[model samples]
Target: MGLLAAFTHTLEITLPVFLMVFLGLGLKRLGWIDAHFITTASMLVFKVTMPALLFLSIIQADLGRALQPDLIGYFIGYTAISFFLAWAWAIWRHPRVERGIFTQGAFRANNGIVGLALAAGQYGDYGLSVGGVLAGAVIVIYNVFSVFILSLYSDEVDTDFRSLIKNLARNPLILSVVFAIPVALSGIELSGWVMTSGGYLAGMSLPLGLICIGGTLSVTAFKRSSTIALDASLWKLVWVPLFGVLGALAAGIQGPALGIIFLYLGCPGAAASFVMAKAFKSNDKLAANIIVITTFASMFTLSFGLFVLKWLDLV
Candidate 1:
C-alpha cells in the first residue's frame, strides 16, 4: 500500500506538470499564445522574476555545505562525459548542423523552473542549493561546448571569443550563484520587511514558475521533426540517465545527492535550444525536435531515476 501510494502521488504530481506543458503547446496551436506573448513572458521571467527567485533561494542557503567542490567536480565530470558521448553519437548519426543541434538536446537537461520546484518540494533549500550549483556547472560546460563544436563545423559569425566570453561570464544562472557568494560569505541576513517579504516572494518561485513554464511550451515545434525528436528522446530519456548512474558512481558520488544530481541531468532539453540554434544558424527543426521529444520523454526518465533512488535508499 505504501509503495502504491508513493507511486500514485509521484504520478499525480509529475504527470500534471507535464500535461500542463503539452496543454500550453495545444493552446499555442489555437493561437492563444504567439510570438509577442512568448517574448514578453520570457523577458519578464528572465530579467526580473527569475533573478528574484534565485536571490531569495540562495540567500537562505548554507553556503559552506553547498560549495562542496568535490560534488561539483562529480557533476562537472559527469556533464563532460555525457556531452562527449552525445556529441560522438549525434555526429555518427547526422551531419554537422543536425548533430550539433541534436547533441545539445541529449545532454542539456532542463534545470529551470520545473526542476527547481520539484527539488525544493523534496529537499527544500538545501536541495535547491545543490541543484543550483550542479545546474550552474552543467550550463557553463554545455553552452561552451555546444557553441564551440558548432562553430568549428560552421561558417562565420560576428560572435568572437571576447563576446562569447562576455556572454558566458554574464550568464544569468552563473551570475546569480556568483552574486550570492558575497551575501553567503558576509554571514549576514535580510532584515525586517526584506526578510518577511522575500521569503513570501521566494515561496512564489516554485509553483508560479512551473505554471509559467507550462505556459511556455509550443505544440507546433513538437510536431515538426519526428525523426530528430524520436532519436533525441530515446537517448535523453533512456541512455543519458543510465550513463549518469554509472558516471555518478565512478565519480564516487553517493547518497541522496547523487540521485538528485543525476535525476536532474535526465530532464528533457530546454526550449532555449531554439534560440541557440538560430544564433548559430544550426537546424531549427532539429532543435525544436530536441525540445519537444526529450521533454515529453523525460517524464519517464525522471520517474525511473527516482525509483532507482528509492531502491538504493538514497532519497
Candidate 2:
C-alpha cells in the first residue's frame, strides 16, 4: 500500500476499536452508565467473557503453527527489560510513593483488547491465532511484573509469595490459557453447540472491554496530569515501542511477528493500572492520568507507527 493507503488502512482498523471507548465515555457523561456499571461490566469482562474468548480462540487455533517460541521468548525478554528500565526511570525521576504506579503505567499495556484488535485487523486469521498464543504469555508476565513492582513500593499491598501464587492460580485469564493449551495440542474437537455458545461469549470480550476502558477514563484525571503521569505516558507510547520495534528489527523479526510485537508493545497504559494502584493504596490519580493521556495519544502514535512500517514494507 502507498503511504496514504497505509495510514488509511491503519485508521480503518484502529478507529472502530477506539470508537467504542469514546462511546463509553459519551454514555458515562450522559449518565446512561455510572461507576457501578463500569465496575460490574469490567468484572464480567475480566472474570467471564475474556476467559471465554481466550479459551475458545486458543482451542480452535493450530497451535503447532501459531506458537512461535522465538517470538514468545523475544516478547518476554522485551517486557522484562522494559519493566526494569521503567522502574529505574521512575526511581530516578518520581517520588518514592509514585514510582511503582508510574513504572507499571510506563510498560504495562492493554494488549488483550487493543493489540489483539489491531493484529486481527492487519493479519486476519493468522493474527488472531498468533496473537492469542502470545496473549497467554502476556497475561502471565504482565501481572507478575505488575504485582512485584507494586508490592515493592506499596506497604498496603501484600508481598506474600503464596498470595501471589494463589492469585495467579485463580486468575481466569491465566487458567483459561492453561486449560486451552492441552486441549488444543490434543486436537480435541468441541461440539457444535459448545463452539457456538463459546463464540457468542468470545465475541463480547473486546467491545465490552473497550467500552469499560472508555467508561473508566476520567476527564478530571486528564485535567490533573502531572509531570509524573505525563512522563510515564511518554514512556508507554513512545520509548517502549521505539526500543521494542528496534529490537525486533535488529533480531531479524519481520512480517506478522514484528507487527504483533509492535502493536502489543505500543498499546496504551492499561486501565487495570488504575484499579491496581487504588487497590494497593498507590497514587491512583496518577495512574488514571497516565491511562487517559496514553489512551488518547495512542490513536495517533499507533497509526503513525503502523503507517511507517507499512511504507517500509517491514510488516
Predictions in order: lDDT: 0.70, 0.88
Query: What are the root-mean-square deviations of the candidates from the true structure over C-alphas?
Result: 2.6, 1.3
Best by lDDT: 2
Residue-level error in angstroms, candidate 2, position 105: 0.8
lDDT of 2 by residue, 202-311 (tens): 89988988888889888888988999888999999999999999999999999878999999999998877887888788888888899999999999899889888988
TM-score quality measure for candidate 2: 0.96
| TM-score of model 1 vs. true structure | 0.88
After TM-score superposition, the amount by which residue 230's alpha carbon in candidate 2 deviates from its true location, in angstroms, is 0.6
Per-candidate total of colliding backbone pairs: 0, 0
lDDT of 1 by residue, 1-315 (tens): 256655665565467567766665666667887667667766665655666667766767888777788878877877788788878887788766577777777777777666665565567688787777666667778778777766665575444667778987877777877787789788787787887775675555555444445565655766676676688777777887777777777777777577567667777777677777788787777777677667766777677667656655555
Report residue 257 deviation for candidate 2 (angstroms).
0.8
For each candidate in turn, the TM-score is 0.88, 0.96
